[model samples]
Target: MAHIPIEAVPYLESAIYLPMLLIVLEKDYELIEHGQFKLKRPYVHLIEEAKKLAQRDLQDVKAYLKSHYLKVVQGERDELFTEYHFHYKQILEVRRYSNIRLRNRVEELLNLYLNKASQAHSAIQ
Candidate 1:
């Protein structure tokens, strides 16, 4: 097993899961829009802002990966664990993450990004 660079771990993980987060946010936005909520504007705005932030962060992550000549490739996956190949220069490190862990990490990231967006919105007011 090749050693994975510590600095690249977060970027690699984000590159894998941020797209999943965006899809989840999009669906949640649609659901909130159509759901029976008297005050939907706040919810909608938060999701919109969070989505924008996530997208921007994802682009930055991609740029970082490109500049560092790093790549993550999805490998075999099962219900419990998903496999990924992290390539940096001549090193190819294989990692397996549990599905539950991935879900939890994304949820945590969503809350974090949402809070950041909320703070930004509050600051503007």
Candidate 2:
């Protein structure tokens, strides 16, 4: 008896398929036919898990984008600074490190928001 390698299990599962056609003569088995190949059976579960993880990451990113927009409008300078400090690399990359005009425009908008929030806060006190 030969011991089967565990690593070969995935390969075997991937190759496993329903025979489309079988030609048998007299009682002895003849040809076994199959169809187009696809990913291993075990990998289907893993693929689904990976898709869920990707969707979760995308949702987190979207939430962050929306929160950033709202925070700017609310004049949360401290929070904005913290967020930008953590994501400076991403910011630079997204803006392509070009277009000084755009950068300045972003700064102006943030400042405007912050001032408005501060004024509103002071009025409440």
Candidate 3:
């Protein structure tokens, strides 16, 4: 194991989980589109905006990882936790996250990133 930079951890974790978030968002969008709702536009709009923001952030995360020469690889998995291998330069660090924890963290990060994006947009307007 190697010492991983604290600053890089979030981006590395995002790299592992953002795609999962995006897929869930996509499915939710479809479900909302077909499900019963009094006003679907608002829900649809929110999901669309969230999706766009998430996609943009994911791209930024990828670029940051690339520039920093950091790579994250999915490792072994069992019924409980999943392993993620982080590669920086010639060093390798492995982190294990439980399935429940991974889901919770991704949800937290989604809200965090979305709020950050919304705040930045508001400041610009």
Best model per lDDT: 1
State the TM-score for model 3: 0.82
Please report, in order, the local distance difference test score of every candidate based on alpha carbons.
Answer: 0.93, 0.30, 0.86
| Global Cα lDDT for candidate 2 | 0.30
Worst lDDT 10-window in candidate 3: 113-122
Lowest lDDT 10-mer window, candidate 1?
1-10
- Give the TM-score ranking, best first: 1, 3, 2
How many steric overlaps does candidate 2 have? 1
User: Between the candidate structures 2 and 3, which one is better when assessed by lDDT?
Assistant: 3
Residue 119 deviation, candidate 1, in Å? 0.6
Task: Pick the winner on lDDT between candidates 1 and 3.
Answer: 1
Worst 10 residues of 2 by lDDT: 17-26
Q: Per-residue lDDT for 24-65 in model 3, tens only?
A: 778988999999998998667667777888898899999999
Report the lDDT of model 3 for residue 11.
95
Candidate 2, residues 1-125: lDDT per residue as tens digits?
33333443322221111010000110111111122336343333333333343344445544554444311111123412311111221232111212343345434533443354455555666
